[model samples]
Target: MKLLFNLLAFTALIFTTAANADISENSLAPQKEANFAQNYLDRFMQRDFDYVMSLIDTEVAGTISPEKLEEMHGYLPSGKLLSTELIGSQVKVINDNWEGSFTFEYHFEDGWALASAYMIRTEGKISIAGFSVYNTPDSQKELNRFSLSNKPLGHYLVLTMAIIFPVFILVTLVTCIRTPVQKRKWLWILFILFSVGAIKLNWTTGAYHIKLFSFQLFGGGAVSASEHAPLILTAGFPLGAIIFWFKRRSLIGQKKKTQKSQTELKESDNSV
Candidate 1:
C-alpha cells in the first residue's frame, strides 16, 4: 500500500513540473516578440542584408528592388555605432499573424543621433512589412531642430555679417587705392586684388547661400554657410575686420607719440 502511494505522489510531481515549465514559456513569449523586433534592427545595422531580406514578406519584397532595399534600410549613416536603444514598440494581430512597429534610437560615431522605425509582420517569427526610407518623421524633427529657421539670433547675425563683410572689403580696397604714397599704394592695390580674387573664388565654390527674405547671397537657392567654401568666406570677413581695426588703432597711436616727441625735441633745441 505504501509503494502504491509513493508512485501516485511521483506522478503528481512530474505533472506539476510540466505545468510550471509551460507557464514559464508562455510568460516569455511576449518578451520574445519584442526581442525579435530589436534583433531585426541590429541585423539591419550590421548590414546583414541577406538575413534581412529573408525576413521580409515575399509580397513586400517583390515590389522593391534588392539594391533599393539595401539603400533604404542599411547603415547609410557612416561611422561606428556608438549605442542603440529601443524607445518603443507596438504589436497587433492581423489575420493570425503579428504586425509590429518598433522605434530604435542610434547614436553614431559622428555624434549624430537618429531614430529609425521598423514595420514588420510575424508568422511565428518577425518579417519586414515596410520601413521608412529617407526623411522619416523622427529624422525631420531632428533636422528642424538644427535648422536655421529655429535659431533666430544666429540666423540674423549670420545675415548681418554676410552683408557687412563685402562692404568692409570694398572700403579697405578704396582706402588702399586712394593713399598718396606711390609704392605703398601700388603694393596695397596688388594685395587687395589678390585677396578679393581669392575671396570671390571661395564664395563661388563654397556654395554658401545667404538668404534673407527674397535676397540670396554667396550660395544660391539652398546652400548653408557651413559648407567649406562658404564657411571660409563667412569667417574670413569678420575676422579680418577685427584684426585690421586693432592694427590700425595701434599704428595711429604710435604716429601720434612720434609726432609729440618730435615737437618737444624741436622746442627744446630752440630753447638751447
Candidate 2:
C-alpha cells in the first residue's frame, strides 16, 4: 500500500510541472510578438527601409512601394529618437491565421512622443502589419515650465482680456443706459476702451482663432513670447475691477456728503 501511494503522488507532481510549463510558454507568446513588433518599428524609424520591408507581409508590401514608404517617413516630425516602450498588445487566432498587434510609445527629444504600431502573423511568422503616428501629451516637466514661462505672457493676456472684456462691456453698457451719472459713465467708457485694447491684442495674435469656434483654448500653453501674458491677464480683470469698484464707491460717498451739507446750510440760513 505504501509503495502504491508513493507512485501515485510522483505521477501527479510530474503532470503538474508539465502543465505549469505549458502555461508559462503560452503566456510568453504574446510578449514575444510584442518585442518583434517593437523591433520592426525601430527599424522603420531608423530609416532601414529595406530591412523593414523585408519583414512586412507580402500582400501589404505589394500595395506600399518603397518610394511611398520613404515619402511617409520624410513627413514625420523632425526629432532624434530617444526611446520606445511597448505599452500593450493584442493577439487573435482565427481559421489557422494569427493576427497580433502592439501599441508602443515612442519618446523623442524636445518633449515629443507618439504611440503607434501593429504586428500580424501569417502561418506562424510575425510581420509588421501597420504603423500610425498619434500625438501624445507633453511631459509634465516641460508642460509646467512652458505653461508658466513669461514668453507666452502675451498669449495669456490676450486670452484673459478676450474672455473678460465682453462681459465688462455688457455691464458697462447696461450701467450707462440705466444710470443718470454722466461723470461715472465716462469712466466706464474708459474701462470699455481698455477692454477693446485687449480684444485688439488677442485679434492680432489669433486668440479668437481657437476660442471663437471651440471653448477649449490652448491659451499660452506652448513655448512662445506671450507665455507669461496669460498669468498676468488672468489676474488683471479681477484686480482692476476691485480697484475701480472701491474708487467709484468713495466718489459716490463724497458726492452725497457734499449735498447733505449744502442742504443743511441752506436750512440754517432760511431760519435765520
Candidate 3:
C-alpha cells in the first residue's frame, strides 16, 4: 500500500511540472514577439538595411534589394532616436498560421511619428508584411497643401520667411553681445528653424500629420518626397548665421581695443 501511494504522488508531481512548463512557454511567447519587433525597429532607425532585410521573408526581401534599401535609408534623418513606445498590438493564431499587428512610435525630424505594421510569423520568426502611416484626414490635406501647393505666393512667402527671420536674428545677435536680448533673439531663431524644418519633413514624407486638417485639404493625394534644398536652407542658414555672427563680434571687439590703445599712446606722447 505504501508503494502504491508513492507511485500516485510521483504521477501528480509530473503532471504539475508539465502544466507549469506549458504556462511558462505561453507567457514567454508575447515577450519574444515584442522584443523582436522592437529590435527590428531599432535596426531600421539605425539604417542597418542589411540587418533589417535579413529579418524579412525572402519574397519581400527579393522585391527590395540591399541597394534599394540603402537608397531609402539615405532619405531618412540621421538624428539620434529620442524614445519609442509600443502603442498597441494584436496577435492571432489560426490553424498553423500566426499573424500580428504592431503599432509604435519613432522620433523623426525632431518629432514623434506613429506607424502601424502587420507582421506574419512562420517558423518562430516575424516579418513585416505591411505598414501604414497613422494620420487624421484633415492633417493629410494640410500636409498636401504644404507640399504640392507650389503656388507662387505661398512659395515666396515660405522661402522669404525661412531666410529673412534667421538673418535678422543673426544680425541682432552680433550687434548686442552680452545682452539677454541678443541671447533671446538667437534662441528664438533656432527654435523656429528647428520646428519648421521638422514640420516640413513630416508633412512631405507623411511621417506625421494633423489628421483632421490634413485629410480635408489633401483629399487622397500622396505625400511628397522631402526636398533636400529647402530643408538644407532652412536648417543651415540659422546655424551658419549664428557661427559667423559670433566671429564677427569678436573681431570687431579686438579692433576697437587696438584703436583705443593707439589713441592713449598718442595722447601720452603729446603730454610729454
Candidate 4:
C-alpha cells in the first residue's frame, strides 16, 4: 500500500511540472512580442539603421535597399522622448510566423502623439513591416469639432485658452492673500476653458507625423508642421508657465519672510 501511494505522488508531481512549464511558455509569448516591439522602437529612435535592418526578414529587406532605408531614417529628427505608454496590443500566429499589433502613446518636446505598428516574426526575430495611425472613429468626430478651415473659432479658442489658463492660475496663486474673491472666480472659469481646449487639440492632432509629404505638393511635412505648432504652444507653453510660477512664488515667500524677521528684530531693539 505504501509503495502504491508513493507511485501516485510521483505521477502527480510530473503532471504539476508539465502544467507549470506550459503556463510559463504561454506567459513568455506575449512578453516576448512586447519586448521585440520596444527594442525596434528604441533602435529606430536612435537612428541605428544597421541594427534595424538586421531585424527584418531577408525578403522584406530585398524590397528596400540600404540606401533608401538610410534616406528614410534621415527624415526623422532626433526627438527627445518625454514619455511612452503602451495603450493596447495583440499578437497572432500565421503559418509559423507571429504578428503583433501594438498602439503606443508618446509625449515629446514637440507634443503628444499616438502610433500603431505591426511586427512580423521571421527566423526568431521580429521586424516592423507596416504601420498606421491608431485613431478611432470617435477620435475623428472630436477632430472635426475643432475644424481649423471653417473659421477663426478654433484658432482663437486654442490660443486664448493656452495663454489665459496659465496666467489666471499664476495670478490667483500669487495674489490669493490680497484679492481672494476675484482670483477665485477667474481660476474657476480658466480651469473649464483649459480642459475643453486641451481635449479639442488632442483629438485634432492624433500623432505628429514622422514622414511628411512624399505624395504631393502639400507634402506630409506641411501638415505635420502646421499641426505641431499649436500642440507645442498649447501644452509646452503651459508647462513652462507652471514651472516659472512655482519658482517665482518660492522667491516671493522667502522675501516676505526675510522682511518680517527684519521688522521683528527692529521692534525687539526698541523695547530693549
Candidate 5:
C-alpha cells in the first residue's frame, strides 16, 4: 500500500507539471527590450521623431514618413511627462520569433494616456512593430451600462431575449427532469441543455449580430474578456429544450408500452 501511494503521488506530480508548462505567463520584457521601449517612449515624448523612426523595423520605417509620425504623436495627451508606469506586458514566442506588447500609462501634468508598444524579435534582432496612444480609457465602465436610450430595435430585442431566455431554459430543464421518461432519459437531458441559434449584442456599442448555425452550451449568457472589456450578451433559441417538451408525452407513451409488454410476457410465462 505504501508503494501504491508513492506511485499515485508521482503520477499526480507529473500531471501537474505538464499542466503548468502549457500556461502562458504575462512576464516582464527582456532587459534589452525594456530599455529599448523606454528609450523610444522618451524620444517620442521629447518629439524626437528621427530617433524613433530609426528604432522601427526597416519595412515599417519605409511606410512611415516624418510628417506622418509627427501627426500620430500629436494625438498623445499634451503636457509635461510627470511619470511613467508599466501597466502590463506579455509576450508570445513562436519558434524563433517573439511577439509581444507592452502597455504603459504615461502621466502628464494635464492628463494621462495609455501608450502601447508592439515589438517583434527574429534571428536575435528586436525592433518596434507598432505603437498606439489612447488619451481616453478604452473601458466598458466609461460607457453606459443598462440604459436603453437611442439603441437600435434589434439591440433592444436581443437584450430582452438575453434577459429572459435563460429563465425559460431552466424552467424547461426542471420540467424535463420531472417528466416520466424511462429509457435514455439522460440523452434527452443532454439534448435539452444546448441552444441551437444565437443572436449577439454588444453591450457598449449596442451593435448586434445574428448566427443561424451557432450552438451555445447552457443557453444564453454574457461574457467579457476583462472587467474593463465590454460585456457581450448572447441569446440563442432553446430549440432542443422546446423539442424535448414537445415529444415528452410520446416518450412517456413509449415507456408505458414497454412496461405493458413486459407484464404480458411475465403473465404468459406463469402458465408454463
Candidate 6:
C-alpha cells in the first residue's frame, strides 16, 4: 500500500510539472502582444497622446483627435506608475493573423487602473483596434480581497458544505482501510480515493460552478487565480466514499461467511 501510494504521488508530480512547463512555453507568442499593450498604457499615462495614437490603426486614429483622447483620460487614476501587472490575455487566430486583448493592472499608492489593449494583426502589421481604462480607488480593491466579514449568507452555506464534504470523505477513507473485504480489496481502496463531481465556489463572489460528471483527487480545496485575487473554494461529491459506506456491511458479511465455510470444510474432511 505504501509503495502504491508513493508511485501514484510520483506520477502525479511528473504530469503536473510537465503541464506547467508546457503552459509557460506556450505563453511566449502572447508576450509580444502583452508588451504592445504595456507600451500603449505607458504612453497614455505619460499624456503623450501622439505616441499613443501612433500605435492605433490609421483608420481608427483618424476617427479621434488627440484632444478627444486626452479628454477621455479625465478623472483617470494619477500617480507615479509604481508597478504594472499583466492580468489577462486572450488571442484568436484569423486566417494566419491573430487578434487579441491584453489587460493590465496599474497600481498606485491610493488607486489602481485596469487597461485593456485590443489589437489586430493585418498584412503583417500590428495595430490597436480598441482600448479601455477603468480607474478604481484602492478602497474598492480592499473590499474585494479575501475576508470573512460582509460575506453573503450563501457564501457561508457553501463554505460549510465544502468543509463538511472533505471531512466526510476522509472519515470514510479511514473506515475503509480498517474494514475487511472479501476480494479485490485493493480495487475498492483505489475507488474510495476519488470524488466524482465538481463544485467550484468563488470565495469573493457568491457564485458557483458545478459539473455533474468529473473526477477529482481530493473532495475539496481552496485556490486563487492570482496572488492578489480572493480565494476560490472547490469541492466534489464523494461518490466513492458513499458507495464504500453502503457496501461495507456486505463486505464484512462476505468475509465472515468465507471464514465459516473454510472451518466447516476442515471439520468434514477430518470426520471422513
Candidates' C-alpha lDDT: 0.47, 0.51, 0.48, 0.48, 0.71, 0.73
In candidate 3, position 268 carries an lDDT of 98
Model 4 reaches what TM-score against the true structure?
0.35
Stretch of 10 with least lDDT, candidate 6: 17-26
Tell me the number of clashing residue pairs for each predicted model: 3, 13, 19, 5, 0, 0
Off by over 4 Å in 2: 1-29, 134-272
> Which ranges of candidate 3 are over 4 A from the true structure?
1-29, 74-78, 131-272
Model 2, residue 192: what's the lDDT?
Answer: 35
**Residue 113 deviation, candidate 5, in Å?**
4.2
TM-score of each: 0.36, 0.38, 0.36, 0.35, 0.74, 0.73
lDDT of 6 at 65: 80
Predicted candidate 1 versus true structure: per-residue lDDT over 26-63, tens digit per residue: 23335666567667767766767787777777778886
Write down the TM-score for model 3: 0.36
Over 4 Å off, model 1? 1-30, 73-75, 94-97, 113-123, 133-272
Model 5 C-alpha RMSD vs. true structure (Å) is: 9.0
In model 5, state the lDDT of residue 207: 75
Order the candidates by lDDT, highest first.
6, 5, 2, 3, 4, 1
Give a tens-digit lDDT track for model 5, residues 159-248: 678756665666666777777887777887787777888988877877778899988765676665433345677888988888987898
Instruction: Give model 4's clash tally.
Output: 5
Off by over 4 Å in 5: 1-39, 80-91, 103-114, 137-140, 144-150
**Best by the lDDT measure:** 6
Model 6 spans with C-alpha error above 4 angstroms: 1-32, 57-71, 90-100, 122-124, 139-144
- lDDT, candidate 4, residue 83? 65
